[model samples]
Target chain A: MKRTQFSLGFIVRRSMVHRRVRSLAALLALTVSAAVATTLLTLYVSLNRQLHQQFRAFGANIVLTAPDGSTLPSETLATVRAIAGSESRIVPFAYAVAQTADGAPIVVAGTDFNAARAMDSWWQVSRWPNAAAATPGSPVAAMVGTRAQGFLHGDDFPLTYNGHTLALHTEATLRTGAAEDSRIFIPLAAFTAWTGQSASTLEIQAPGSAAQVEDLLHRLRAALPGVQVHAVRQLVESEGRIVDRTRSLMLSSLVLIALTVGICVLATLTASVLERRRDFAIMKALGSTQHQVALLFLLEAALLALAGAAAGYLLGSLCAFGIGAWNFHATIPPLWQAAPAVLLLNLFVALLAAGLPMRILRTMEPATLLRGE
Target chain B: MATILQSAVGSEALIHLHGLTREYASRAGAVRALDQVTLTIERGEWVAVMGPSGSGKSTLVNILGCLDQPTHGSVRIAGTDVHQLSRQELDRFRAETIGFIFQQFHLIPYLTALENILLAQYFHSMTDEDEARRALASVGLGDRATHLPSQLSGGEQQRVCIARALINQPPILLADEPTGNLDAANQEIVQEHLRTLHRAGHTIVMVTHDPEMASLADRTVELHHGRIAAERRADLTAQK
Candidate 1:
């Protein structure tokens, strides 16, 4: 017999089809493992950046506050920008207690409405107050928080601070679902003019790694002397803790599921090999070496694993998308880099699971094995 | 006296076994399967092995087929000490030398008839589909090449098994109760194929209890326990 162009692939492929039930069971095991692995890994890797962005949306992680009863220098925002770069959103804020017409005091916040809109993206606003839209010397435009809207109404209202009165008209209604909901916002120019106070705080969104953020913090402290530069450790710590816990949860889940799939595949493949003992015996009797027979089985497993990994990667990406939307109201992009790693992992799992059956196959004596039949 | 094939006892003898013993170890201690059994068969001779259950007939054939090794003594086939070769070398030796047919027909149920024959060729050397089809055709199953073992009748399946066994063209053919699982008509069909193979000058070793089947062989050796008890030449029995 001439050794023509023979294909082990055909044998492996046809054999998988022949034993459809066992092959499907093994495939299901590998597919589930890969899917879960892809989902958790995608979430874990994406969430590190995602959670950081979420925390930023929650508010700033770095706040610049002037110490004592003083106020920040006029050059503080410029200095912070020079250090933090254009990527950072620096919104300087000032606050004063002002009395309404009925004598009730409400907290009025002075901020750059443009910068605030960029920094506090989570705020749901009815509309933003455009300074250009207001005519010169007309009533000042104020964006009122939803909670503060009840106190000051009728489109325009008067508030007196330190014997100076400013008439403000509602330009927008802001709802932040947080402390910002209980205050009122007016342009820094109008507030500084009415209250005779400079900007006192700057909420900074520094986008970078922890090391980069620390470097930025160090530069901020060095640049502004007598100015208090502090990180909003609450937000930073919460972000860190949430990300850490989420990663731990993902790692444990991936491990548990991997172990479970490994065991299930082990059992499934073992049973498949056991059921085919006769076939193996016949092969051996027909002059197939132990190595050859084992190779055939492992090839089948690898084929199953590779296929399962591809299918699982696709399904898992969709699952991650669904989970991201359900939990974060966001879309999680597929991590393409994880594809090769996932393929290798499933192959390792399948080959490892098949090891036991091959061992059994090695110990088998074709004559003794086929004796019962 | 146990009779041997007089015409085959020359340089043409293809199998030589001397004091071949096979033992099985169990909790009940070791049990001897083939005790000091010496046998020889020349090339192109048909020999039948006859015995009751547990009489070591299968064991003898298994050792002869190189599926089992002897605990003592040796088997030399085609001028090579089968046991002296390494495990891997012995596998190759078996592939080039022996073909086995079992009573159950032992066809890989998943493979089609053509594929079953191709499997043997695959393990031995190369798989030739045309050659495999022709081998199937020789056994009167050429049209059923695409049929699975489950789809074939008992006799047809046996023919496919025989084609698979011969596809590699091994010098020796080993059959263990080849007709044991077949109906009367199927048995006759299988027997006729065996007779055709015998006439084609292929060496055949068949294990059977049917006297009529044994009479088809050149000689029949009856086994008792682990030892040969009686032998008869078909030519001599015909003379009687």
Candidate 2:
């Protein structure tokens, strides 16, 4: 009698297809693990970038202050700009203690209204002083802070600094909940005329890593000698610690999920293999070598793992997109770079699960099993 | 009431066993199944082994089929020492040289009858669908090729087992109570297939407790307490 030529692949496919329930059970288990691993890794990669952007909203990590009771040179803003490049926003401020009509001492700050607005967009203000209305040599338009607004009786007020009188028109009121809430804002040009002082401080919004910020500080100190240039440790350190801790937490979670999923896959595969013990025995009795039997099982597991990995990649990428959009208001593309790691993880889990069952199959006595024992 | 045929019927002894013994370790010391028993079966002979339960009939067949190893003895089938071969070598020897038919009809329940036959060919070498179909037809299962073992009756399942056993075209076929699970009608059907194989010069060794089935063999070896009690020609027994 002629025999049909059957390859290992055909038998494996037939066996898997024939036992649809068991195959689906194993496939579902593997897919869940792969999905979890893919999602965590994807989030881990994008979270760093997203977190950095979020921290950017908290304003600058570097601030340059003048020496006590002294003012920075008027040329300091230009020098800092030249050194820090165009990636930074530099807003220089000049201060003056002025007396109002009622003889109350008030702190008045002068700066480029547009630059200040851009640098501190998170500042809550009722309205911003009209930059177009406060040109040089015009009626000084002031954006009074909540505390300073209490001293003014109306929109028009007169402030005297060192017996030099200047009339101010209140344009808006600001409420920043910080010390900025007690000062009044006017154009830098106007402050220079009223107080005869140049800029005294520089508030810089710089975008970079901590090392990059340190490099900028070094360059700033070198470029502007005798000026106090330093990183605001509160902002810089908190940002660094938050990002690092979050990454560590994410990594640990990924490992824990992988271990849990691996165990689940192992349990499901073990049961599947155990259920097929009779089939294995029959094959052994039909003169199949232990190696051949083990290869068959491995092939089956590899097939399941590959399929699950592909499906999980798709599912996890969608999850990452959802999380990114919900939290960061941005769509994160699929991290294809993680595909290899995901595949290896899934394969490792599958092969690890198959190890015990293959050993059991190898040592099984064909004669005893075939006798229905 | 007996005729002793030559053990070495041809140029060489087809199956030669010398002091074959198999022992199992139990809680109550060792249990000897086949103790220093030696036997030979020549080519183109249909020999039936008759014994009660726990008489080592299955153990002897297992050793002969290379499915088991003897604790202390040598088994040579067709001049190849079964006990001396490696695990892999014994697997090939079994695939190429021996065919086993069990009373339970151990066909893979998930596979069709035709696929079951092809499984044997896959283990032996490559599968030939035409050859598998012919094997099925020869066993009167040509129309039931696509039926799974579970879908078939007990007798039909046993026929599939027979087809699978002979698919590799081995010289030796071992049947351990091939018809032990069937009724009279199915038993006759299975016995007819066995007779056809025997006529085609197959070396058949069967284990059966039915004297009627034993009488149909060319020779019968009765075992009493793990030793051969009688070896005689089946024709002489029918004559008696």
Tens digits of per-residue lDDT, candidate 1, A41-118, equal: 888788777777776787687989999857898888888888899978899899998998888889999998888888
List iRMS (one decimal) for every candidate.
2.4, 2.2
DockQ of 1: 0.49
lDDT of 2 by residue, B170-232 (tens): 888999999999999999999999999999989999999888888889988877677777787
Which residue runs of candidate 2 sit more than 4 Å off their true CA positions?
A: A1-5, A68-105, A108-122, A125-144, A153-174, A185-199, A205-212, A323-332, B1-11, B223-232, B236-240
Candidate 1 deviant stretches above 4 angstroms: A1-6, A67-71, A85-87, A96-107, A117-132, A145-153, A160-165, A172-183, A192-198, A207-215, B1-12, B235-240
Maximum-TM-score candidate: 1
Error of 2 at A313 (Å): 2.2
Candidate 2 docking quality: incorrect, acceptable, medium or high: acceptable
Clashing pairs in 1: none
Please tell me which predicted candidate would have the highest lDDT against the true structure. 2
> For model 1, what is the alpha-carbon lDDT of residue B161?
85
Model 2, span A138-173: residue lDDT tens: 568888999888888898999999999998888888
